[model samples]
Target: LNIAALLHDVGKIGVYDSSLRKTTRLSNEEILQLKEHPTIGAGIIKRIDFFHDIAPIVRSHHERFDGHGYPDGLANDAIPIESRIICVADAYDAITSKRTYNKPLSPLKAVEEIERNSGTQFDPEVVSALRNALEPNDLPTVQLNEDDFEEFEIPNECDPDYL
Candidate 1:
């Protein structure tokens, strides 16, 4: 699940740089284009036998608990638990991190937004777990941006050369 979580957004690599870096709202057409990332991610993973087990989880991570999300509309228990967990984490990260389109929300505000969307956009249980697991102090003060990439090390365990 951890590996899946890390790689879930890999498909974004296929998105055009203009779309990925857009600082304004995407057009409806662009939104449609952006929504293909999940499917594209799953396809990429499925092609690798080592990651087959996680492909479905990646594909469904964007699905909302209320069945209104893109690519597929799976709701509630129909969604993989890993995907559910990742969805909440992804949303929290997105909300709390500075993005091209918006300023980062305070951790408190991000948690509030997650709590507000608990039963609809996210799994209520997952939200509860998140609330239970993290205090405001546990969050990073700054989002890791491209400038920080040089300092971000892939742990030895994650480097195939080490294996």
Candidate 2:
């Protein structure tokens, strides 16, 4: 699960930097292109014999509990449990972490947002687990400035030498 979580966005290496770095709203085309990261990441992970088993989990992390997400729209039990857990974690991090497009949200607000989307954008069970794990004072607090955000090139193609 740890490996899957760490490498879940590895497919983003194939995404155009312009799309990723855009501060304004993404156009429909850019949004479509960005959505392909999971599949791309899964393909790259599958090439490694050790990570083959977790490729499906990586591929399904974006899947919604209500079968509305891509690349495959898997729902409920059809989606891997590990993927479901990662989905909630990923959303939490994305919400709380500063991004070029948006300001960071408070952990409380982030959790509220996640709670509001429960059973649709996320699995209810996973959301429940997250709620149980978090305590008001235990939430992570990391301060990051603009300097913490750096743009580095990720190889467009998978190379064993780089790995």
Top TM-score prediction, candidate number: 2
Instruction: Kindly give the stretch of ten consecutive residues in candidate 2 with the minimal lDDT sum.
Output: 136-145
Model 2, 1-163: lDDT tens digits are 9999999999999999999999999999999999999999999999999999999999999999999989998999999999999999999999988889878887877888999999998999999999889976776555466686898988756787666
lDDT of 2 at 8: 95
Q: Per-residue lDDT tens digits of candidate 1, residues 4-76?
A: 9999998887788888898888888888888999999999999999999999999999999999987899999
**TM-score (all chains, Cα) for each model:** 0.83, 0.84
Local distance difference test scores for all models: 0.89, 0.92
Please name the candidate that would achieve the greatest lDDT relative to the true structure.
2
RMSD over all Cα atoms, model 1? 4.6
Candidate 1 wrong stretches, greater than 4 Å: 136-163
Model 2, residue pairs in steric clash: none
User: What is model 2's C-alpha RMSD?
Assistant: 5.8
As for candidate 1, its clashing pairs are none
Residue-pair clashes per prediction, in order, are 0, 0
